[model samples]
Structures are given as structure tokens and as C-alpha cells.
Target: MNLKKHYLITMIAILILFFSIFSILTKLFLNKGFLSIEKKYKDTQINIIQTLLENEKYSLSNIVLENSYWNEIYNAVENKNIDWINNNLVYYFSSQYDYDFIKILDKDKTPIINYSKYDIDLNINKIDIINSTFKNSQQYTDLVNIDSNFYIISSSPIFDGLGNKAPSGYMIIADRIDTSKLENLIKKIYNFESLTFLSNKNIYFNIKYSTYIPLKNNNNETLGFIKIIPKKDNIKDYFYKIHIIFLIIFFIMLLIFIYFMNRIFETINSKIKSTVHQIDLISKGNYNIKLNSNTNIEEFDMLSNSVNNLSKTIKEKIDENNKNYIEIIEAIMVSLEVKDSYTVGHSHRVANYSKKIAKKLNLKNIREIEVAALIHDIGKLGIPESILNKPERLTDDEFDIIKTHPEKGYKILEKISYMDNIKHIVRFHHERIDGKGYPLGFKGNDIPLESKIIAVADAFDAMTSDRCYRSKFNIDQAVDILNENKGSQFDPTIVDCFIEVLNEDMEFKKSFAL
Candidate 1:
């Protein structure tokens, strides 16, 4: 063979070797990475479902607690006022609480008033289960399976009145954990495609991709399993797309290298070297770098212009991808807000406030801080709407559930590579400088500066916004509250900067005006 043909054969061999290595690495690294991420995503979804179940139990317990501890109910039971029990307790529990079974037992555990939604005879086995588990020292809140159906039962000792310690009898409220209820909760929280509750099967399946999370009772005994059939088009697809893009770029680079090698001896060496350097810059993400080829050869000039045009095209695609990413993030934030109507536009206001504070403090990456502020509450989507929109005060349990939002938000955003920088900020936005914050409770300088800024902004907007339980605070009151807790709940420097920002910016001030 001639020299050119010999060179071509040698280059083809090299290309084949390179392709084999690339394919192996892509499978080992890219596929493995995708599997790892898929596992994490499924784990997150399972945790979310577990949290949702816990919240539902807590909510049901609260409902039962509210009714059981009331004075009127206690008096009605003590007086043996059958009419009062039938009219008030029965109607209220059935209609208002939406409980499937309402049973009021005497101090001796004798059933006084038994009511069921289906008008069937009260299950003697359920009463036995309640009696077996009830402790005089504490209230009973648990999941009980009655005749193959799961129910969340809350049993509280009946007191004579609020703050009364002596128990008269027991008030038990049971709500069936029906498929419809679980589906609704899953839909609200995750928007998952399909969720199945499996019973008495091997919890550990040999399946490669199926997700299985065990459903446990309050006692931590595995009762059943939640099988989540994940949506096929999940976040893994996003990472796969990234890998595909990398593969495409690799091929383009390889072809360019081969083209340059073919012309190495014939073309002006300087021009080929310059074109290769430009390609290197493009590979390094400096897409604006251009080649000034003056070799006077037609091929050299055409190659230079082609490289430049490719750079522009790549830059445009990058810009478009960035724009699309921002839109997706905004859409996610909007979806979270939509779940709780009372907090509509709250995130936007927080972002604006955060940006203003960042500017006032002369902070770097002001845009990133603002974006973090916008998504700080994304975890709130995991919280139940009943707790979020509750017209009354939140119980300590409810508040604890609410506090998990920051961590939930962090878990969600941490999965996206681009969101790594802001994930901690989202997680720690509620952190106090005094180490009293939840999730991690990082104190003072340990909390991220972005988080600190978002905290102040979050607090100000929360206070200024009208909520279901409280009227909107006037600007002065909000400012005074911020000042009161500056060093304790919030970072002092961020607070001061935010206060200055609010005072100087009329538009920002007017935006929060009551």
C-alpha cells in the first residue's frame, strides 16, 4: 500500500481502539452513575411517602385529640346524655372529622357510643385491639389492621375539661387507610404514576428497577410494603441526555482530530496548529475563541470559518439550555406555591428581597442567591396541605413536620448537578445563628451566606404576608420583629443589610406595604 493508504489504515485502527475504550467507559461510568442516581431518586420518593404517611397519622391524631379532650364530650358521656352523644359526637365525628368509626368507651373500656360509616356492627376485634394497646399513662396513636383493612386509630383519655388531668373514659377515632386516600396523598405530594400497597409478600424483590418501601406501624413493625412504579421518564433521563451530549462532543472532537491528522503533511503546519488550538479552546468551554487563519489556502480559510460558526452554534445552544433550565426551576417553584394558595407570590417576593440584600451587602453571585431564595421553600411541597393551610395553631408535632421541608428541599435539589451550590442554602435557610434551627442546626458562620440572606428575606416576607391564622404585619412591626431576633434567629450582618436595603429601595418597600 502507498503511504497515504498506510496512514489511513493506521488511523482507522487507532479510531477503533478509541471507540472500544469509550464504549466501555461510557457503560461503566455513565451507566453506573445513572443507576446510582436512580437509586437515590427512588429512595427520596420512598422517604417522601413515609413522611406523608406520618403526617397523615399526626393529622388524624390531632383531629381525635381535639374531639376527645373537649369538655362537652366528656360531660355528655358522664351524664349518659344519649341524645347529646347521638346529635353532637356522632354527627361531628362522622361529618366534620370524616372518621370511619367513632367509639366512646367508659373508664372500664365498655363501649358507650359506637358509630360506623357503613352502619354495620362495630368490629369487636378492633375494640379488642384498642383495649390491648391502650395505656393509662399515655395516649394511643397507631396503625391497626382490622379485618384486612388498615386504619389509623387515635385513642385519647377523655378529660372533664381543658387542662383537666383526671380521665373519665376513652375516646377512639379511627380513619380507614383506603386506597383512594393513599392515592390522593401520593398525587398531591409526588405526582407519581402508580403506587401499590403489597401485603404478605417477599419485601425484597429481585427486580432491578422497582422501588419498595416498607410500611411500618407506630411500633415499627413492618405491616405491609409500598411498591412505587416510578414514572419511566424520570430525572435519570436528564443525566442520560448529558452523557449523550458528551458522546456527541467526543465524536466531533475525534473527527476533527482525524481531519487535522490527514492534512498534517500537506497543509501549512502553522494553520493546522492554530485550528487545533481553537478546537482545544472550544473543548475547554471557551466557545467564543476564534481562529485567524491567514495561510491563503482555501481549505485553511474554510476550516477557520467553520470552527468559528461551530463555536457560535454551540454558544447559542448553551444559552438556550441555560434559559430552559431557569424556566424549569421557576416552574417547580410555581408548582410548590400553587399547592398552598396562601403563600402565592411569596417566593418571588423573597427572591426580590434577597437580591436587594445581596446587592446592599456587595455579595458575589447575587443572581444565585436570588435563585436560592426563590426555591428555598420548594421542600414545602412535601408538607401536607391540611397542615399548611390549617386555620388554627399548629401542634408541636405538626410544626416538627413542617420543619422537615428545608431538608426535603435540599434532597430534591441536590440530585440536580447544577443545583449543588444552592442545595445547602435551601437546606439551611431556616437555620438560626444561635444553633436552634432544625435539620442540621448549623450556627453562625457555619450557615451559608446565601442561606443567611435568604433567611432574612424569608422572615420579612412571611411576616408581611397575610396568612390564614394571622393578619399581615405592618412594615414597622415586621422591622421591629427582625431587629428583636437579629442576632439570635437571623445573622446580624444580613439583617442589617436587609434593613438598609428596605429603607433605601422605595419599590421594595412599597412591594411589602400592608
Candidate 2:
């Protein structure tokens, strides 16, 4: 991965982490908050039940304090108008006080008035408060209905208040709270936003359809659970929309990553191309080429400047080397010309032409060709002037003496300490690739590359320039002869290489005209 890509990825990863943590915290907080509200509502219901019970107690006690009302009913009991008394009392109390029924019973707990007329001889022993009211003549108390609707029965004994144990009769007041009204009130209070349930015994109810927040009292125990089942609310839609938005954000980040990666590769590639071009110029002896300093980067700038400085130093060294090489070649050539004047400028022209040939052949050892061409005739001093200066074609014996120059030059040059590897050219320059022209008659592949190059240079210069007795051939005709004799008098590759350089639009062609 790229450093810039790594940085961007890390940023995205941290952002996701932050969001993940934020969402988790938000859920936890919502859960705790909902539970707190549930506990509050449960407390409110408990308080409502307690207040209603207290109000019931207050109204029941007031009925016991009103003595004259029950005293008038007892007078009707004495009149033996039992039907009138039962109908009148039932109609008065049931219609006025929301009582379920009003009943008047005899001393043996036989009902003299059964308001609804369900049973007259009903056993009321399960009514604890009613038993207390009949036995101890208490004024008002509650009782349970043993064989009736779930009801609250408030009873008062028909007492004379004379501290007597006997009571004339009892006043039974009963009422039943409506179950439908209770259900409607609970649903209204805790509405559609939440699922609310109330259970006295171990019953449970679920109201909503999404997330569930369990109900609890103040003790923090889950009394019942309310489920908000997975459904579509505005909040749910909002979070789902957010998720899609972030997914697109992540995808966009990936595309941006690829963009930066490609940019880095292209930038490095351009820098490499610039470096290669500069190196090619340096190879062509263009040392004046300087690298740009303002590349807008550090490492490439350093590398460019370093190469320019190195090429600059190498050029300076090569200039000094050329000076020494020229002086040495000129001195040796002048001395050889003193003995055989025909070979005076032959070495210099060959050295000059050989450099261009080596370049056209893509040869790396050009210095070897220059050195060999300049000193090729240095060994002609050992040959007799009769054969070297002969005006006509030499006899085989005299020609054999002239051919010894390559080996003689090798032996002489091998003694010079600074010319290491150039001795091969001097010794083998006369050796042909086809073993047709040489002091030793060495064959193809037995020739050194440098020697082959020098042989082509020596032959080309000799043909194009005036010799001791032969007139010079034109450059084009000389080129044709060299090409035609490839693989016989010359190494075919070097002969072709030399001709190609001679035909170039270079300074030599323009300076040296036929």
C-alpha cells in the first residue's frame, strides 16, 4: 500500500470506529432511559390504586355515621310491609349509590330481601367483615361475595346503639368497578409510542412492535416486558438512511485511494524518464547538460545534481586524456614520416576516421581504436624503405616484410606501461576474419574486436588518401570496394561498420572532398 493510501484508510477506519461506539452508547442510554420511565409509570399506577381505595373507605365510613337513614328502614321492618320495604330500599340504594344489589336478611342469616333475587338462603360465612358486623353489631365493614360477581360488599348492622349485642338487621351496600373502563384508561395513558401492560397476578401483555423495553418497579426487577417490534417509524427510517449514506462515503473513499496511487506511479515514472534522457546526452559527450534543481522534490533533485556533477568531472578528465594521447601520436607519427614520408598523416586520418566508425558500430572500446590507428605505422621503422616506398606492387618477399608491422607495433606498444589492452590491436590488426590478410594469417573469431575495428580504419584511410605511388580512390568507390571485399580482406562486420560511418553527413565528408 502507498503511504498516502494508508493514511486515508486509517482515517476512514477511525471514523467507523467512532460511529460504532457512538451508536452503541446511544442504544445503552436509550435502554436505561426507557426503563426509568417504565418504573415511573408503574409507581403512578400503584399510587392511583391506593388513592381509590382510600376514597372508598371515606364514603363507606360516612354511610355508617348517618343513623337516621337506617333507623327509618328499621321502622319499615317493624311494620311487616316486607315487600314495600325491600322494593323501596333496593330501589333507593341501588339506584342512588351505584350498588350492585341491596339485601336485607333475618336473624338466622336468611335473606328477607334478595335484591336481584338470585338466592335467599345464601351462606355468607366467607364474608368476614359481614360476620363481624352481625356478631359484634359493627356499623360498617367490607365483605367478599362467596357465590356472586367479584364484588365489594359494605355492611352496617341495624343497631339501637344501646350497647346491646342484638341487631335488628343489616344494610348491605355493594359495587363493582368496570373492567372495560380500566382497560381503556391504561391504553390511553401509555399509548402507541410504547407497549404498556398491567398484570396483578402473573399475566403478561405486549403492545407495540419494535424494540422492547422491559417494565420494572423501583426494585429494578423486570416485572413484564413491552416489545416495540421491528417496524417502520421515523427514527428507524432515519437510521437506515444514514447507513446508506455512509456506505456511499466508504465507496468514494476507495476510488480516491486508487487515484492517489496512480498519481504516485506516474510521478516516479516521469522522473525515471528524465534521468534516462540525461544519461543518453552524457554518453554522446554532451557534458554541458545540467539537471534542473527545481524538480519540486528532494530525492530526485539530489540524484539529478549528483549525476550532472559526476558527468562534469568525467568530461574534464577525458579532455586531459585526449591532450596526452594527441601529443604522443603526433610525436611518433612525425618520427616515422622522417624515415618513410609516405606514411606521415596516414595515422592521424585513420585515428580520426576510426572513431566515427567505432561509434556507428555501437562499439564501446573507441579509445582502443584511436590509440591503435595513431600508432599503426610506428613499427614501419623496422621495415626496409625499399619495400615500404616501392612505387609498384611489392613482390611477395617485400610484401612479407611490410606485413610484419602489426606484430612489431604490438611488441613496441606492449612495452609502454600506460597502453595495456591496446597491444592486441597492433598485433592482430592485419589478421583477417577469413584468414586472408595478416602477418600470422589468423582466421575468423581469432581476431580481437579492437583489432578488427582498427583494420577497417587502416584500409579505409589508405584507399581514400594518396599513397606512395597509387592515386586515391573517391570515398564512395572506396566504400564500394570495402563492402565488396567483406569476409576476405577485412572482417565483414567491421568493413560494413566502417562504410556506414564514412557515408554519414559528418564533418569528415564536408571537410575532405574528392
How well is each residue in 106-197 modelled by candidate 2, as lDDT tens digits? 55566677675333333556566677777776654442333322344567776554324455666666554334423443343222343333
Encode model 1's per-residue lDDT on 63-140: one tens digit a residue.
665566678878887776878998988898788767898888777777888888755444545554465535543466
Cα RMSD of all models vs. native, in order, equals: 8.3, 56.7
lDDT of each: 0.72, 0.59
RMSD of 2: 56.7
Candidate 2, position 32, lDDT: 47
On a 0 to 1 TM-score scale, where does candidate 1 land against the true structure?
A: 0.62
TM-score of each: 0.62, 0.38
Among all windows of 10 consecutive residues in model 2, the one with the lowest summed lDDT is: 188-197
Task: Tell me the lDDT of model 2 at 359.
Answer: 83
